[model samples]
Target: MSHEEIIKTTQHWLEQAVIGLNLCPFAKAVFVKNQIRFVVSDAKHLDGFLDDLDRELVFLAQAPADEVDTTLLIHPTLFPDFEIFNDVQALADDIVAEHELEGILQVASFHPDFQFADTEPNDIGNYTNRAPFPILHLLREDSIAKAVEAFPNPDVIFERNIETLQKLGIAGWMALGLQASQK
Candidate 1:
């Protein structure tokens, strides 16, 4: 698929799955405020993708929070394997630490086949991190800290998300039209 199509699909998933299911309580705020940057990377190699990621991290760090609070660096062609994606995610996190952005920035990973360590492959909870393509969600640590502070019981977000997705089930999730992109 083309980059535009990938972005549209990713946006649709964000609307119908992430926000629609309330997986992320903070997502709607940034999304509605148009503070989320959706970047589609066309890099076919890992090195090129890492370069793009580096650029995005720098861009987000330098940009004003009001103008760009978060970024979804979507990679459509690279890291199709979830394991490889996870490896790259680790590298990205290392980059953040190396840049001394440990408290200033963070990276959240997502993939079409995202599965938790102990969960079954088809577990509904995995859907919480699933997206149309491999994505490194770059977020401002300060924003996350503030959001968590304002949110009640932020520590229970993972369990809450699991409960929410379990209630939704595979059938309900399929109804959202996200499964089509995975295939």
Candidate 2:
């Protein structure tokens, strides 16, 4: 699917969360454009960010796609830290192992130390100053199974996530953990 399609598809998924989260229309658009994976730090403000998608989020669609390499470059912003990402990645690996995936589902997240000033690697995706965190670009999927395998158990991850949002309020939620930020 094209980038627009991906954004739209992701929005559909977010819609389900809106019932409880009450996300604003614009925030929904921004989150999808930025490719912020499903997460809510402050259930209240989760919609706020959705209402105003940062310009950085919009560029995610324009990112170049890889033809031969199927690496999924995940920006660090997606998770709280490397440990969380590693757990998620391990979960993905488990899914792949269980499903017997073909092709590759390589992963990459944000490296706080990696600077844009450094020489660009041909294989790595570009980083945006606006969305300074990290991002995940699923390079390729031989089948739907491979693509589906990339995600972790949302119920498990978001269970505490929702509570955190409720307790922390919008500002608090944003500051607390790896809540989804569209920008």
Candidate 3:
């Protein structure tokens, strides 16, 4: 698919699944303020993808939070399998530590198939992290601290998300149209 189509699909997933469902309470603000950066990776090889990732990590680390609070490095076709995506995610995390941005930045991940350990592949809870494609969500730790400070009981977010997804169920999730991009 073309990059525009890829971006549009990713944006649709962000709007319909992430924002519309309120999966992330902090997301609405950044999204509304246009502080979220969406970078589509067209790398056909792992080295090229890693290079792209490196650039994004540095850019996010240097950029002001008000101007770019977070980034979603989306790879629509590179990671066709969840396992490969998960492996790449580990490398992405390692890059953060290697860069000495351990305390300043971190990498979170999302995929069309984001199964948690001990959970079935089709578990409703997995929908919480399901996105249109493989996405490395680069975030600033300070932003997380501030958001958590302002929000109540941030520790309950995981449980809350599971409950929210369960309540929504597969039917509701399908209605959101995010599953259309599923591999």
Candidate 4:
């Protein structure tokens, strides 16, 4: 499909499948100038499987719509499991497919120790490595070596994702709290 075609089709899928799937209680639509976002619920039906384009499309198609896109941020805690860790390759493939997307999607992942705001670099094992956008459950911030295995280098990965977002030019930060009922 042409770039325009891909974007239109993907947006359609997002509206029809992702939002419709109702996979999470918090699925909803988010409208940015150039992109649309889908806030996810605490559901794992399609974890680690979305690293491929086809799989991602399928997921977007199968996702439920009852929820609202409160804050479509991506984080590893959302998909915590060893299986997703082991199948990183497949997951990456699905993500690679997303490149077919005319524009880009921004996903977020945080390291476990990120909460330790006062901790020093040395005190922490090593958070020098860069991680992929939707951090794999297996990769952590402290291990640059492991992070490198996913990309050429952790720094490059960080630089690239950040740069990509900057280039997009229209960015917003939203925090959609998980409802108490989910717990």
Candidate 5:
């Protein structure tokens, strides 16, 4: 897909799923403030992707918190298989540590097929993390800490998300039009 379409689709998922479903309660604030950065990776290979990862890590680290609270580095075609994408997630973490961002910054991943461990492929709970494409979510630790503190019972967020998706069911999620993300 074209860059514009890729970005638009990601935004659509954010609107229809993340924000609409209240998957991540903290997301809406930054999203409305335009603090979420959507960057489509232009890497040609895994090695190149690592370079792109390094660049984004540095960018997020140096940028002011109010200007860019988070970043979604979307790579449309590099990781079609969830396993490969999952493995690369470890490397992403290593990069953050290498840059000495272990506590200050972190990386979370989301993909069309983001299956949680021990869950069936079609489990509704996995939908909590599913996104339109392979996404490396760069988050600020401070922001997370602050958000968690302000939110009531932050520990129950995961259980709440599972319950929410379970209530929505797979069919309901499909109705939301996120199946296109599986591409």
Candidate 6:
């Protein structure tokens, strides 16, 4: 897909799955403020994708928080396998630590095939983290801290998300029309 198409699709997924379903209670605020940056990386290889990742991490770290609070680094063609994507996620963490951004920045991962351990692949709950493509969601630590502080019972977000998704079910998820094509 073209860059514009990729972005539009990702945004649609955000609107339909994340914000529409209230999976991330904190997403709507930044999204409505236009503080989320959607970056589509054209890299076809892992090393090249890491270069994109490094650039985005630096970009997010240096940009003013009010202007760019978070980033969804969308790579359409790389790491199609969820296991490989999970492994690459570790490299992303290492990059943050290497750049001394452990506290300043953190990475959250999402993929079309996101699955929690022991959960069935088609479980509705997995859709909580499912996006149209493999995404590295870069978030500011301070922002997360403040949001968590203001939100009550932050620990229950996961359980709540599972319950919400269970109510939605696989049929409901399919109704959103954002599921990535199965490989």
Q: Which 10 successive residues of model 3 have the least lDDT summed?
A: 174-183
| Full-model lDDT for every candidate | 0.89, 0.33, 0.89, 0.31, 0.91, 0.90
Question: What residue pairs are clashing in model 5?
Answer: none
Q: Candidate 6, residues 1-183: lDDT per residue as tens digits? A: 899999999999898888998888899999999999999998879999999999999999999999999999999888789999999899999999988999999999999999889987877778888888999999999999999998998999899999988888877887888774374
| Model 3 vs. true fold: TM | 0.95
| Candidate 4 TM-score to native | 0.25
lDDT for each residue of candidate 3 in 91-122, tens digit (9 for 90 to 100): 99999988899999999999988888898888
The positional error of residue 8 in candidate 2, measured at the CA in angstroms, is: 16
Of models 1 and 2, which has the larger lDDT?
A: 1
Return whichever of 3 and 6 wins on TM-score.
Answer: 6
Q: Which ranges of candidate 4 are over 4 A from the true structure?
A: 1-40, 47-72, 75-78, 81-93, 102-125, 128-183
Task: State the lDDT of candidate 5 residue by residue for 3-111, as single tens digits.
Answer: 9999999999999899999999999999999999999997889999999999999999999999999999999998989989999999999999999999999999998
User: What are the runs in model 1 whose C-alpha is more than 4 Å off?
Assistant: 180-183
TM-score of the candidate numbered 5? 0.96
Pick out the ten consecutive residues of candidate 1 with the lowest summed lDDT.
Answer: 174-183
Candidate number achieving the greatest lDDT relative to the actual structure: 5
C-alpha RMSD of candidate 4? 15.3
| lDDT, ranked from best to worst | 5, 6, 1, 3, 2, 4
Per-residue lDDT of 1-183 in model 2, one digit per residue for the tens? 444543443344344433224322223433444434422212133233222222212332233322122222323233545345445444444444443432433333333222233434211121111122323333234322433455454334335543534554535423422233332
Candidates 5 and 6, the one with greater lDDT: 5
For candidate 2, report its TM-score.
0.25
lDDT of 6 at 24: 88
- Per-residue lDDT of 14-126 in model 1, one digit per residue for the tens? 99988898889899999999999999998878888988988999999999999999999998868788988999999999989877889999999999999889877787788
Give all TM-scores, in the order shown.
0.95, 0.25, 0.95, 0.25, 0.96, 0.96
